[model samples]
Target: MSFQGEQYPGVKAPAAETDGFRLNHTMLRIKDPQAALDFYSRVFGMQVLRRLDFEEMQFSLYFLAKLEAGDEVPEDKARRSVWTFSQKGLLELTHNWGTEDQADFAYHDGNAEPQGFGHICFSVPDLDAAEAWFDANEVEFIKRSDQGKMPDVVFVKDVDGYWIEVVEAARMADKGD
Candidate 1:
């Protein structure tokens, strides 16, 4: 399939290579664990599914997920660990010790001059409500939904300056038109 005069090769991957494979999570380096936790939990309703601390290494990993209604997290650590790995679309936050104490500390949000990573996205049930909540909470926005060419979408920043794109799930049905 091609769009906008660009040809897209119809590529196929070996079934064996993709059969049992799933994307586990995407990791983001955070300077302050508490701050990052607060932002993700409060803004996106993500819960910390599991926390792994490497005290000897002076770092920690926090796995977060947005649990669905009536879904319960496994109580057993082993089961929870397995479940966490089995689930798709998880966010992992890594915190290196002592970073919070530094007066001038910030993570490379991957959207600077030589941008590498772009942004994480959240599909909300109501984009307008989400934007309003963000505004009321004084969340920093890189681009407001109404200001963009795609008026129904929003881009906001987290405590560590990572960009998060917010869009209404209903918009997906519209195909951006």
Candidate 2:
């Protein structure tokens, strides 16, 4: 069945939320800094928020995310040709130039799945619209099964092959009122 939050539509939309403390970002280990930066910037439109270079370590980290107008992106961020806005969810890229033995892993590749680790999910107002957008953009969903009475939910991989779950929230809107 669909999930219907009591205040979904009838009431004024849920008040904008402030998560007590500001969330900093998410860090990812990438092989090629330039390639990874290009992929996220070109495909997702995420701006580079910041960068930290460790000369001794020979590694560079790039922080990219959505940005709002007038947001001040540090000068270092410009070095990567990426920018960030005042938005949530920042993607941090860790690039090590001298390290060659590091093991590579995807978000879903490890067993024990570990606590504090899970798939990122997006709630869509309309599943049909989402599916259409995915089709138009040539995005593929990995596991999409919704034939039964339960609500429709699908899992898809991001550009980096990270699993993301997309759930349909609008179906519940038709149940009442």
Candidate 3:
């Protein structure tokens, strides 16, 4: 069955959503996005639906739903736009964005020949304390937050030479205060 309570090979068009619509997902090249295609996903007796993204949303998960004869789902009405930002960063990883689905990963690592990639960031509860912790642990610093014109922003180099940015949201408030 479909989201609109249609039967198998359902010929009727999706109902004009009154509440809203969800973007569910978008895929490129030789692919189409619709309930018609969505229904066909059950070829494998698919109870699980995989939402696609060219980039990130959940960023680490493919939201799936069971497509059986009867299963309820979010009522999409406004031409599909609800599934925009997913539960963000449940499984944050050290890899390039938008390539999570692929097996082989190619990276620029923010340096060397094919250079473009930069760094990942982390927010700490205490910026000064975190910096002190880094120094205490002998972490290699490209620049401490105090050294840069962009104060309160710390840059530390990992063993792999990739830079990691550390920030504290409270610092913005600190400046304002």
Best by lDDT: 1
Best first by TM-score, ranked = 1, 2, 3
**Which regions of candidate 3 fall more than 4 Å away from where they truly are?**
1-87, 90-108, 112-114, 173-177
For each candidate in turn, the TM-score is: 0.90, 0.54, 0.40
Question: Is candidate 2 or 3 superior in lDDT?
Answer: 2
Query: What tens-digit string does per-residue lDDT give for candidate 1 at 1-110?
Result: 33335345875544766777888999999999999999999988999999998999999999999999987788999999988999899999999999999989998889
Q: Show pairs that collide, candidate 2.
A: 1-150, 47-83, 48-82, 48-83, 66-85, 67-85, 68-85, 68-86
Please say which candidate is ahead in TM-score: 1 or 3.
1
Order of quality (lDDT): 1, 2, 3
Measured on C-alpha atoms, candidate 1 has an lDDT of 0.89
In candidate 3, residue 72 scores what lDDT? 40
lDDT per residue (tens digit) for residues 55-166 in model 2: 9978998877656588665566454343343435777778777433445633332223464555656566667676666666666577663644444776665555555566
What are the per-residue Cα lDDT tens digits for candidate 3 across 1-177? 445564667466666773454444322111112322332232212232334444533232243332435534445623222322332222112222445345463434565676766665667778888788778656778878888677898888653455667889977665642
Alpha-carbon RMSD of each model: 3.7, 8.0, 17.2
Better structure of 2 and 3 per TM-score: 2
Reference-based lDDT, residue 34, model 3: 35
Measured on C-alpha atoms, candidate 3 has an lDDT of: 0.49
